[model samples]
Target: MQNTIFITGASTGLGKAAAKLFQSKGWQVIATMRNPEKENELNKLENVVVLPLDVSDSVQIDQIVKNVTNKYSVDVVLNNAGYGLIGALEALTDEQISRQLQTNLMGVIRISKAFTPHFREKRKGLFLNITSTFGLIGFPTCSVYSATKFAVDGFSESLASELAQFGIEVKVIAPGGMQTDFAVRSMEVGSHEAYEKLTAEVSKGYSPEKLANYTKVEDVAKIVYEAATDNKKQLRYVAGSDAIALYDERLKLGAEAQVANIKSMFTF
Candidate 1:
């Protein structure tokens, strides 16, 4: 039987790329998004089914899992539905902060929980989570966003140990910035007069020239494929050149030095 991958946030960006890539490789792709009706491309692909899934909604997650597991034999569940919440803590509203946690952190947890039983019963499956380079390190404007990703990074590590006995594997794909609509569409930036200078500095990193240097969405999707099929005990796969450079520096400089280095990059 051909393998299958259940992906979240399949409407665009990396999720869409992964859906197309996996479908081309002969795997059944269960591409879930908030608005499946709006999707124009992936639905037409062979062996690819686009379903509606709002990961933050627990009831919806349970229903989707029940329906999909009943029909398709999912070999991998890719928890890739998330958005960036960027701002100094004071600049962010409670609603934005809560929503970020709901979608990015709670959403992944709920989806994974819903599929755990199916994977356990099957005796083999992969839980591939898309985190971020910020998950591995801290940043100024990305405080809450980094928190969500970092939580997932730690959650995946613990869940990996818990699920090992059940023949289930949990892996994390931590990619750096990508040249995708995420910056425009999937990111929310809060504003505060007090932090204007700091926000401006952070915004510089997202400029056209800087973003052009980021990794391609398609390339990171390939790493997602590797983590699914590599059959190794690896827990984290850092994708992209920028991500690799930052991660390597972290290793060389150690945690304390890395923090100081990041701090030195910004000024008040």
Candidate 2:
């Protein structure tokens, strides 16, 4: 029998890539996006079902999970729906803050909660959460975004212990910058004149040379597949060379020294 994976934010980028990869691997893919009508490719693939989901909406989340679980035995759930909220915190609006928190943090929590009963009853399942390198190490412009990812990281870590008794595995996929439209389409920048120098210094880190080394969406998707099927007790899979290097540096330097190291990169 073939297994099924339910993915959120599957219309584009890493989510879309993962859906395709899993489908190619002979697994059924339930690809959920905010607008399934706008999706053109995944809908046409065999063993792939495009469903509508706005992870921020609790009602939609519960209903969709119920409908999918009833019809298909979902073996994995991928929480890949989130966007970046960059720039100065002071420049960010209350609406932006709320949206980031709702979609990035709460969305993951709610989705995990919705599927907990099913996984618990079946006594086996996997949850692959798409966090970020920012989730592991703090950055200048990613305060809010980092907070959300960090919370998810911690949440997954704690939840893993509790769910292990039921054979439910919670894993976090933390990737660095990827060659995606994330910067162009999936990010919201809050600009404020007072913080121009800080944001500018931060912007310099995204040099062309650095971006050229960013990992491909498909590559990260492969890592997701590995984490899903590796059947190891590993709780975190850091994808992308940049992500691995940075995280390794953090681990080697220790927290305070790592913060100072990152701080030394920018002068504002």
Candidate 3:
């Protein structure tokens, strides 16, 4: 039987790309998104199944987990359903902050739990969590987004250690900015005229193309595949030019110095 990969947020961007890539590599794909009605391309592919999933909805998650586990075998679960909340800290509302954590952090936790029983029973499984460079290095504008991703990083690290004996491998994929709806459709911008200039400056630094940034959806998918298949017992797989540089620099200079170095590059 072919290995199956269950992916979240597969309607577009890295999720969509991974669904297509894995299918080409002979893996059955359970491509899930918030709105399957919006998906057309993924459904056309053979051995690909598109399902509706909103990570923030726990009931739906429970149902999907039950259905998929009973019907088909899943070798890997890619938690790639998340969006960025951009703009000034003052612009962020309490509800927005809660939703950000709920969707990005809580969602991952709940879904992983739903799949844990199955993986534990089999004594083997893989979890590829999609984090970001911001998760590693703190920046100016992405306070909440960074918090959620950073939480994922810590969660993956601890979970990998905890589940090491269970024959389950939990890893993180931290891709820098990529060319996708992530910057537009997947992100929500806050409004605060006072921070408009600051947001613009911060936004410029995040652009995947500008200043030789790192944000290619295809490249991200390739890295995602590598993280899923690689057997080196690696923990974190980072993609993109700028994101790689950030990861490297963090290793060289410590946290404080790394943040300072990044801020020095952008104009205030």
Candidate 4:
């Protein structure tokens, strides 16, 4: 039987690419998005089921899980539905923080919780989360976004250890600066003059326009496929050559040293 996989945020970007790749590789894909009606591209794909799933909505998540369980035995669940909120910690509003957590951190928790029983019952499955390099390293104007990814990184690592006994594998794909609509849709800027200088520096340094020049969306999709299918799975797989280099550098220099380096770059 072909392995069954469910991917969130399948409407576009890495999720969309993964859906196509997995389908071509003969996996049954439950490609989920916020609006299924609008997902014409996914709907047209063979072996792919376009389902409505807004991760923040508990009722919808529960329904999707039950529906998938009834129709197919899901072998893997990819939690990729999330956005980034760029702003200074002090400048960000309570609501903004809540929204970021709800989608990025809490959404992963909710979806994982809903799928746990099924994976436990079957005693075989994979849970892959799409995290970022920011999870391992922090930067300015992305404190809130980094927090969400860091939470995912910690959660997946700990969950992997706990789930190992059950024959279920958990993995995190940490990509750096992929070319996607994520930057345009997920990025936000704070509106405070007090931190305008710092924000401007951040804008110049971490500009999506610049980062897109290096990372491709397909690169992330390929890594996602490897994580999903590899029998000897690692806890974390860093996507992109640039990301791997950065990860190596971060390891060489301890956390304190890395922080100092970043501070010097930003003239902080």
Candidate 5:
């Protein structure tokens, strides 16, 4: 029997790319999106099942897990459904903060909890989490976005330890800027004049040939697929040149020094 993989936020970007690659590799792909009605491409793929899933909704997540468990034996669960919250913390409304934490951090936890029972019962499975380079370092206008990823970083690390006893693995994929609509579509900006210069500086970092440190969706998909199927007991898998640069710097400079270097760039 083919191994079944359940992926969240498969409508576009990394999720969409992973779905295509996994299906191509002969895995049963459960490509889930918030609005499956708007998706046309993935549905056309052979051996790919497009389902509706908004990770923030616990009820919907539970229902989907119940429905899936009976039909396909899911071997991996990819928590890739999240958006970017950019801008100064001062400018973020209560709702914006709540949404960011709920979707990026809480949502990942919710879906993982929903599947824990099944994974434990089988005593085997992989929880592949899609975090970001922002999770490891701080950016000027991406405070909240980075916080969400940082939380996932810790959560995945701890979850890996806890689930290992049950023959399950928790892995986090933290990549740098990818060639996606992340800056445009998946990003929500809360602007403030005090942070305008920093925001502009940060925007320039995403350019193809410069500080933006862009990555390809296909490359990320490959990494995720490998992490899911490699059967290795590794906890963290990182991708992209920019992300590597930051990771190396953090190793050499230590967290405080690295953060100070970033803050030195800003006037505030």
Candidate 6:
């Protein structure tokens, strides 16, 4: 039987690419976003249903779960509905911080909780989270965003261990950067004048600006397919060539050296 996958944030970016890729592969896709009206293109695809789901809204999440369960036995749940809130920690407001956590961290928690019962009953499922390379290493001007991703990383790690015996796998994808509207729409900048220098430094490291950056939406989609379809799942998949290379470099450098190198790169 073709597996069914439910993806959050399917309106654009990697989610959009994954939806198209999976649909081409003949899998049933329940592509959800904040607005159903905005999904005309995705809805026109075969075996793809564009549902209304605002991951930050609990009511919407519960309703989508019920609708999905009634219509299909979803085999994989991709928690990809998140945005970046870039700012110095001191300049960030409580509301801004809360919004970041709500959409990135708590949203994942809510979706996972709603689907856990279904996975438990079937005893087979996968939860894939789209994190970032920043989750592994912190950087300036993206501290809050990194914090949320760190939460995702820790959550996926702990949940993977907890759900292993139950046949549920939790995996995280840490992509360095990609050519997507994520940089244009998903990033939140702060009002700290002191952050100007830091912001410039951060901009240089953006995945889109990097030379021959290997993190593409389709590339991440393929990795998502592997995580969903492969019997032996990996805990995390780095989705960018630069990320993989940098990860290796970090590993070789010892902890102290890695920290020093990162600090020098960011001038932090």
Number of the predicted model whose TM-score against the real structure is largest: 1
TM-score of 6: 0.94
Better of 4 and 6 by TM-score: 4
Best candidate according to lDDT:
1
lDDT of 5 at 30: 93
lDDT of 5 at 83: 97
Query: How would you encode candidate 5's per-residue C-alpha lDDT over 187-228 as one tens digit per residue?
Result: 898988877888888777656566244778899899999998
lDDT of each: 0.95, 0.94, 0.89, 0.88, 0.90, 0.86
Please report, as a residue range, the 10-residue window in candidate 5 with the lowest summed lDDT: 205-214
lDDT tens digits by residue: candidate 2, 1-268:
9999999999999999999999999999999999999999999999999999999999999999999999999999999999999998999999999999999999999999999999999999999999999999999889999999999999999999999999999999999999887887898999999989889887765667666779999999999999999999999999999899999998888889989977887765
Lowest lDDT block of 10, candidate 1: 259-268
What is the model-wide C-alpha lDDT for candidate 4? 0.88
Tell me, what's the RMSD of every candidate? 0.7, 1.0, 1.7, 1.4, 1.4, 1.7
Structural similarity to truth (TM-score) of each candidate: 0.99, 0.98, 0.95, 0.96, 0.96, 0.94
Per-residue error (Å), model 5, residue 56? 1.3
Q: Candidate 1 vs candidate 2: which has greater TM-score?
A: 1
Error of 4 at 105 (Å): 0.3
Where in model 4 is the C-alpha error above 4 Å?
A: 205-209
Clash tally for model 3 = 4
TM-score of candidate 3 relative to the true fold: 0.95
lDDT of 6 at 189: 67
Residue 60 C-alpha lDDT in model 3: 97
The residue pairs that clash in candidate 5, if any, are 205-211, 205-212, 206-212
Would you list the rank order by TM-score, best first? Answer: 1, 2, 5, 4, 3, 6
lDDT of 1 by residue, 1-268 (tens): 8999999999999999999999999999999999999998998999999999999899999999999999988999999999999999999999999999999999999999999999999998999999999999999999999999999999999999999999999999999989998889999999999999999998998998998999999999999999988889999999999999999999999999999978998865
Looking at model 4, which ten-residue stretch has the lowest summed lDDT? Answer: 205-214
Residue 144, model 2: lDDT of 98
Lowest summed lDDT across 10 adjacent residues in model 3 is found at 205-214
